[model samples]
Target chain A: MSELEIAGCSKYYKKNGEPMCALAETDLHVKNGRFVSIIGPSGCGKSTLFNIIAGLIRPSGGHVLLDGKDITQESGHVGYMLQKDLLLPWRSILDNVIIGLEIRGVSKKQARERALPMLKNYGLGGFEYDHPDALSGGMRQRAGLIRTLLYDKDVILLDEPFGALDAQTRMQMQNWLLDIWKDFKKTVLFVTHDIDEAIYLSDEIHVFTHRPGRIKATIEVDLPRPRSEKTLMNDRFLTLKKELLLMLREEQVSSN
Target chain B: MSDQLKDNEPFIEDPSVRTTKLRRRAFVGQVLVGVIILFLWEFLTRLGWLDSYYWSSPSTIVRTGWKAITQGTLLQDLAYTSGSTILGFVSGTAAGYILGLSFWWSELYSRIFEPYMIAFNAIPKLALAPVLVIMFGIGFDSKVVLAFLMTIIVAAIAACSGVQSVDRDLEKMLVSLGAKRRHVFMKVVVPTTIPWIVSILKINISLALAGTIVGEFISSRQGIGRMILYAGQVLNIDLVWVGVVALSLLSIVMYLGTVWLEHVLMKGRAPKS
Candidate 1:
């Protein structure tokens, strides 16, 4: 059985008193413990879809299912990481990481105990008491990811989590993220505009059309696992990158 | 080559050393300015170019202050004034913050009350001092009520804005993590509003004092304002100057105390370097 399914979900808004579609009727399925990426042009409703999936907003039509049970319009079933590292400034790094557990009625003492080792494992051990401002950008992002991971949700949705980093840091984060994701093996659906990132991390890439976005194509990435810097120069990686770029360029030109 | 290299070395000073030097220079300048002003005042009054009777000399004002202190009247007046200010400030801020949180909790209450709050805030609170005096009588209650009236409006407005100004993304993140309304309020809303509350406390210190003094001016048996009024009426210019000086000192001390509290509360929340 599929772990998650989006069946004909859509969203509409009123602009100047006229109906406008933000997301068309869309269907997607993620098997348990697989990484999927959604790549699109700007303003293509990828975030809107993620918001629906996260239950922050309801779709205009259709349903989202988990384990073949309808979980649409309901929240707290998935972990979500936004583009910016939204760590609460006033909290210590350890306190921030355990917020999810705290909200779930766990005692702060117990939450701290559970979160301490995770912080050390993630390379943030000695800095647990430090403020978010004291951490580097990449470190802050890692803290944010740890916070989401500690939520213990079956599915995790990452919305351009590394978009704000410089290239070197972005590469480092991607490698670190893959290592963590491989170990955890949670159902992952990541959204980004970077085709290289999408190709590198995802088992399948879903290309989206411009505004009023719908799934334009779903291409399977057959690259071998344990992907690294060497994988970037592989012939298969170049071929997949070229194909995705051409598809994205075509969509951009047609929209313009 | 060594001489050339030494000459070419960049001029670097430790940041802490530079800061101390700047602070010392500023302190000297401030003291110098105060001394110059005092000397000019004494010189002008001694030469009879200025009316010493109406505008008492600094030395005479200081002597009167010493007499008031020695006689214990100054201490009594300071205690009474400060007591009213503190009582009113605490109660007013608590009530105002609770009211603001209620408004945040209920949209219907906010919509109905916001316009009235704006209109009430626009009215000059001093004009209402007489009414408060009449209602609460010529005791400590009247001064406290006046101070409460002066401070509550500002605190309510500040607290309301603070609650409303929380980052939407953070709220969403919490909601997605299974946080209920109470969790969100306790974790996100209250912590985010703390800086605003601290700032309003600083502002309320002066405003509460102003309100208390205004009440005392209208009708009060004891207080610095009443002291000033009585001294001026009796043509005791030196006593009046003493009252003014005491009030200025009280304001400075209160302002510095509030600044220290802000530094303590906002220690970890400061922006990244």
Candidate 2:
């Protein structure tokens, strides 16, 4: 059974008196332990899809199943990372990471115990007592990631997690994410407009159309595992990049 | 990021030394300004250019202050005023926070009571002191009630706005983490509202003190306000100036103490600027 299943998912917003569909008749299935990337132009409802899967928003139509259980209405089971770091400035790095555990009724001692290993593993050791205001953008984002991971959820939703970073920092974070994913082995649904990132990090890329977003095509990346920036030079990588660009460009042309 | 504080930077190079320097500079400036003003005032009064009856010289006021302190009258009156201020502040803040949270949690309560609360606050609280004295009598009860009446409105308004100002994104974050309504309030809402509440408390301190003094002015046997009233009636200009100076000092000290406590409570969430 698939880890996540969505059937006939549709969302609409009313502007004035008309119905504006965000996701129309969208259907997709994510297998367990898969790194899936949803790529599209701006305003393509990719974030809407993330919000739906993360149970942050209720779908106007259809249902979602997680691990063979209906979890369309259930919240707190799936972890979501937003574009902004959203780290509470009043909390220390360690306290921020342990927020999820604290919400789940874990004692301070127990939560710290669980969080300490993650902090050390993530190279945030010794800075745990420092406030979020004291940290750099990259460090803050890392803390946000660990915060979601502390929830112990099987699936993680990332919405343009690196979109706010500069080019160099984005590249660095992409590799960092790949390294963390290798160790943690959690299913990741990453949303991004950067086609190179989607191709570099995801096992399968789902190309979405504009406005009323729909899956134009699903292209599997048969590239070798443990990918790096050097892998972008491979012929297959270039070919996949060309195909995704074409699909995105064609969708833009059609929409215009 | 951790290394941001390690360098020999100007303001942050030696945090302790820099903070002490800043404090000392401020103290020096204040003293210089005070001395210059007193010199000018003394010159004017000696030349008979200013009314000495209404505005006594700084030295005369200081002598009166020393006398009051020596006789323990100043301390007694200060204690009485401080007692009423503290009692009213605590009770008013508590009632305001509870009501504000309830308004946030329940729309029914907000709709039913918000208008009445606004109207109550709109009425000048000083005008109600006489009525309060009549109802609660010319004792501590009237003074405490008057102070509470003056302070609680500001607290409730600030807290309600603070609750409404909670970041919606953070609210969603909490909700997705399986935080129930109460947990959301206790953990997210309350903590987020604390800075706002503390700011309101700072403002309410002055209002509460004003209310206490007003109550004493209308009807009271003892208190700093009563002493000032008696001094003014008898044309004891120096004693009146002493009372004014003492009240100003007390207010300044209380305000600074509240701010210091705020810093301690919000150590982690230091403002960037």
Candidate 3:
């Protein structure tokens, strides 16, 4: 039931009194429970496309349809996360996790009751009452992800959620994310410039082209799920990585 | 580090313990410096090396202070000055804070009023003491009004910066979670700005005191300012020194109280030691 569609989306920004193209006409569709990744070179407007879908910004030239409804320039239909955890330093980890619930009128007591178990089930068990500064970077990022998930949105848009982590932690987070995605059955649209990350996590990887980004290629990874570290060394995985790498390199050169 | 620890093992004092010791030593040194200055003044005056008529000695100052405390209107003057300062600071900061927070509700409103606020802030509030005393009259109200004038603009400016420094990305995060405009303000803007508002409390306290003193000097019959002014006119050097000492002690107490309040307001948010 959680399907998303972007129809003829385009974005424009005013730079020095001139209308500059940020995202060209674009169309994207994600069926229920599918995992999609958007990857491209720097300044290729991957984030612009991401924001348009998240409804944080308007597309200027098209509409964003979520669950078959026009949601262009609107927010709150989906959960969003960025590379930085953005946790309020004052609030406890448990409280931070339930911010969205509180915003939607959930009583504090009820929110705490619901979040306690989730916090325990995740690795943040006894650390619930501690402030964000007490947690490691990976733990903080995990808390951020939990916050996004607990928001209970049908679609989640993550813009480089693990981009700030070290290579080892990023690998662990990728596997952890897959488990959560499979268990929750929620549609996810992830954006990253890391080709390996794109191929490892997404069911379909949307490769974006140079500045004024448009979908350059859509590569479908048919590898079996319950994906693990072993999947990273698979022949198909390497092939997809090589292919995405080539496309992104072409875009990066043109952009520079 | 205990005496029981063997001296042969080079003792490493705990960091917190070392910090406490250093702070204690600094306080002792500060008090020692004050004692030396007072002792020298008293000794010099008794030896006739310093003129007692022009430069009152510590002993004379203390005697005058004690006499004023026990018989004169010292307590009443203390209450009046401190009352106006606290009243002015609280009211001015609250009013300006609310006014500044309202700006977040409308961009047009903030932009339209920004220049006016800046212009108002530029005026020396102390210079308006005579006008305020005339407007509010030579009573507690005049002193309170002056103190209010001194603090209001500064509080408003602090709050405006707090509003501007709000994390837009955090606002976006809240919006993505189905939060509305007021929700973003309460959940995001207010908590984020609390630190900013609290930071100005220390500054506003001193400003409020200055305004109160200035207003009292301009017209009021009470307050430490009036007491000092009367003593200067009458050539009561000891009383003037007593008034100066009392004011210093008063301001120190007020400043420490503000630090405590700031600590309380930031209870959960204060950075870990």
Whole-model lDDT values for every prediction:
0.91, 0.86, 0.89
The candidate, 2 or 3, that scores higher on TM-score is 3
lDDT of 3 by residue, B1-273 (tens): 474678588867679978998999999999999899989999999998998888889888888999999999998999899999999999999988988888899999999999999999999888878888888999999999888988898889888999999988888788888889999898888887788889899999999999999898998889999999999999898999989888888899999998999889888873841
Query: Which runs in model 3 stand beyond 4 Å of their true positions?
Result: B1-13
RMSD to native for every prediction? 2.8, 4.2, 2.2
Task: Tell me the TM-score of each prediction against the true structure.
Answer: 0.94, 0.91, 0.95
Could you arrange the candidates by lDDT from highest to lowest?
A: 1, 3, 2
Candidate scoring better on lDDT of 2 and 3: 3
Q: In model 2, how well does chain A match by TM-score? A: 0.97
True interface contacts reproduced by each model, as a fraction? 0.70, 0.55, 0.68
Q: Indicate the worst ten consecutive residues by lDDT in candidate 3 chain B.
A: B264-273
Task: Report residue A203 deviation for candidate 3 (angstroms).
Answer: 1.0
Candidate number of the best TM-score: 3
Candidate 1, residue A232: Cα displacement in angstroms equals 1.1
lDDT of 1 by residue, B13-87 (tens): 568877988999999999999999999898899889999998788888888999999984998998899899888
